[model samples]
Target: MSAVPESNWSAGRPDTGLTPEERAAEQHLELLDRVIGLEQQVAELQSTGLLGPSETIAVERNLAAMRSSMTWRAGRLVTLPIRAAKVVKRRILG
Candidate 1:
């Protein structure tokens, strides 16, 4: 029998020559790792609790990340003013 093409796999899994059950287990492990990573990232962001410019910097970093993404970039126009204000504030405060 012909091996399944890469795209036909569920979850867009690559053809790693593993059996279906093994692939399922591997995907589960991968998903678990991603969840752990996301949790760690959230913890990191939350731990940066600060006030004033430092807090604004943190928010700007998050916004920058969102702006870099294809899907979220749709909202970039809405946030342009906030970014402009930050630029002006930074110049004035510095």
Candidate 2:
């Protein structure tokens, strides 16, 4: 049989040669752009003063709940792979 080439093995993961810091900076810039957009929205809402005190309170509560939910979901997402690995290892060994 013919030998498989090393280039063929790595073909599935082509390298763009970007450093980790460069990738992180790119992601940071994208997140900053989203933050700027959210800031603009908050400013617009403040200038309009469309929400009364009770409505504002309700909105703030909802925003806090959403933030908490997002944080929880993010933590779960980060741990999911480790959890799956543990389950697989337990099934294999136990």
Q: Model 1: what TM-score?
A: 0.38
Against the true structure, what is every candidate's RMSD? 16.1, 19.1
Q: Write the per-residue lDDT of candidate 1 for residues 1-94, one digit (tens) a residue.
A: 2332444245455554677888788778766877888898899888986568888999999989877998777676778899999999999999
Question: What residue runs in model 1 are displaced by over 4 Å at the alpha carbon?
Answer: 1-16, 53-94
Structure candidate 1, residue pairs in collision: none
lDDT (Cα, tens digit) per residue for candidate 2, span 1-94: 2332323222466675556687677667766877888898899888987878999999999988886897878988999999999999999999
Task: Pull out the clashing pairs in model 2.
Answer: none
- Best model per TM-score: 1
TM-score of each: 0.38, 0.37
Ten residues in sequence with the least summed lDDT for candidate 1: 1-10
